[model samples]
Target: MSLPLPLIFDYEEIAGKFYPVIPIELKVNEKRFLTRAYVDSGATFSIFNAEIADYLGLDYRKGDKIYPAGIGGHICAYIKDIFISIHNIEICCEVLFSDEFTVKFNLLGRAGIFDRFRVCFDDSEKKLYLYEKAYSDFR
Candidate 1:
């Protein structure tokens, strides 16, 4: 059986817009882990704070420089590949790595997850729905 879609919520109203936390899982090397991450559609790439990366034991190295919005001006980060999971659905994708000292939470950007899933937000129900396009027609 396929996994059910996850509920979405308005980021602004829920987490004051700075950090819109979404419940999801991170899968790596065939292992699945659960964590709540911030959904940042504005971000061109996904990111994981240092703590989360270390916790997952991801062997990541410094990649090309990336400029991300920060409290001051823009913050620089590195890139790496990680398996991300949501509602039991897992997909390995490239992600940015940064120290938690700069960012408040882990960010889920538009690159990987949003590319494959159709997202719907129900304001009335305060839930966000994520549907895999590949499985949309399957009954």
Candidate 2:
């Protein structure tokens, strides 16, 4: 089933812009949060705040530590496995938990869940379309 991506407005700009944001449920062990996440195609991996790890009983300092770069710069983080649910579809994937508070919200990225679906963004209407893809179709 195809789903719509709810958009959030960024009032920081002159007129501000809307970003495609969707409701997602993140699960780790017994901890879970139903939060909003931005869909970012440029990002290589899903990124979340370290607070989530801490809330989920993870050290947030362990795991495979590495540096990931963004438009602002690079930051150090640890990779961990997490389960995310969107549009009633759930999947387990690798996610980066950054200790720095620079990341204000969770980002849904290509490597994690974005690659699993066909996505389309329509700025005129501020709408996003997502469709789960068949493995054979990608092959």
C-alpha root-mean-square deviation, each candidate: 4.9, 4.2
Per-residue lDDT for 22-103 in model 1, tens only?
Answer: 7778766756568777676677888877666677776555566576775677666777877787766666677887773366
Candidate 1 residue pairs in clash (backbone atoms < 3 Å) = 7-128, 8-127, 8-128
Q: After superposition, how far is residue 118 of candidate 1 from its true place, in Å?
A: 0.9
**Mind sharing the TM-score for model 2?**
0.82
lDDT of 2 by residue, 1-139 (tens): 5443432332122237677777889888878888888888888888988877888887767789989987788989888888898866777888889877476657888875766677777677676777776666544
Model 2 root mean square deviation, Cα atoms:
4.2
TM accuracy, model 1: 0.72
Query: Lowest summed lDDT over 10 consecutive residues: which window, candidate 2?
Result: 6-15
TM-score of each: 0.72, 0.82
Model 2 CA lDDT for position 20: 76
